[model samples]
Target: MRTNLDFSPLFRSSIGFDRMLNALEAASRTEMVDNWPSYDIVKTTEDDYRIAMDVAGFSPDELTITQEQNMLLVSGQKTNGEEVHYLHRGIASRSFQRRFELADHVKIVGAGLANGLLTVDLKREIPEEMKPREIEIKTNIALPKAESRQIEAEKAA
Candidate 1:
């Protein structure tokens, strides 16, 4: 199933938003999305986010997290310890890698694994210069002393 989204109007009206629109378009075209180690994205506050994934068999040492240019990569690989033969294995022990495309200014705060769940925290920090500020409009102007005296003399006469 294909859902068409037209961005021609956005391109004509907006500036410096082409990257965002392109990312959206690429995300929409992505196929065979990974479902392994199910995860949830939660908004803890206005500029904070939390991502929790089910990593039952993976340990802290086996997992690796890295961030580069607005992209977050998480991978897990089980080390070779001892060989074990199981009659019926229910839990998956295979290595897997997950990629998450984060928005601009978003940074990973921390990550932790607890109770078969791996949670990653993120925070968005916009620079002070980029933040909106009130521009003071100059509405008050002083008249020259000569012009003020002339007007007063005319009024008196």
Candidate 2:
């Protein structure tokens, strides 16, 4: 006999099972994506990041970079002629499109394919309005409006 388990409470909190499930689903989907193109994302600084991918057989002319709907998409297709292959094959050369979900205000700086590795640099620009700045207050003033106004008037008279 199986007993019914209530999962209603899991959805009631902020970091609930829903968020976990979403993260899990995203991770699983990304894992199952075209594995021929593997990538690494690293945070280099406070607001800087780098995404490097292994693209051994791909050339700079075969790759494309685009940003659509806040997603940074990197795709590659090798037009370099295909050889009717041998008894064994290791390097993969076809076509692939890899997408990364970008956070708000995160932008792609540029991309380059070098030495068989494609590097895509990213920068998160926090607007001056968003970054916190120190605000100072002068609370030791002697003038309290009414008295200061009377003193100004007396001086004027």
Candidate 3:
């Protein structure tokens, strides 16, 4: 069962969050949920992440990994060989494409395929200007005092 949420009220009150809200709305509206080739996302450290996907029947040459500006695309194309009769068809060998949305400054460091698992490593590299900085505070600075002079009124001018 799926429920649709109305974001009209939030759209009227929020500012500068249209992109985020639109992404949420689009995700919610997706009718077909494809769970093929299960994957896992793990955070190894504060700035490092890893994604492991199960691609049992795919080889390195049959798979393609692409990294766009803020997106990561993984696709697999199975090549058909000579037909062979099988008593039981238990394994899946179909073409599939999966997309992952990446955060700002996140980059793909490396990728490897071993033991039927495709592992992708990512690291977040924040720019120097965007990183948080400490500000120095000065204390006890003295200001110069104004000169005061005594003025005597002219006596009986």
Q: Estimate each model's TM-score.
A: 0.77, 0.68, 0.81
Candidate 2 per-residue lDDT, tens place, 1-157, comes to 4344444465565463674555445555424545668889999999999999999988888989999856888898879576676798788887899888887689899888889899999999988899899998888788766643434444553
Leading candidate by TM-score: 3
Name the 10 consecutive residues with the lowest summed lDDT in model 3.
22-31
Q: Model-by-model lDDT, in order?
A: 0.90, 0.80, 0.92
Q: Write the per-residue lDDT of candidate 1 for residues 85-129, one digit (tens) a residue.
A: 899999988899999999989999999999999999999999999
* Top of the candidates by lDDT: 3
Ranking by lDDT: 3, 1, 2
Q: In angstroms, give how far residue 65 of model 1 lies from its true place.
A: 0.5
* C-alpha root-mean-square deviation, candidate 3: 4.6
For residue 59, give model 3's deviation from the true position in Å.
Answer: 0.7
Off by over 4 Å in 1: 3-15, 136-157
lDDT digits (tens) for residues 1-157 of candidate 3: 8789888788999999887787788778956879988999999999999999999989999999999988999999998888999899888888999999888899999999999999999999999999999999898989799899999988995
For candidate 1, give the lDDT. Answer: 0.90
Q: What is the lDDT of residue 14 in candidate 1?
A: 92
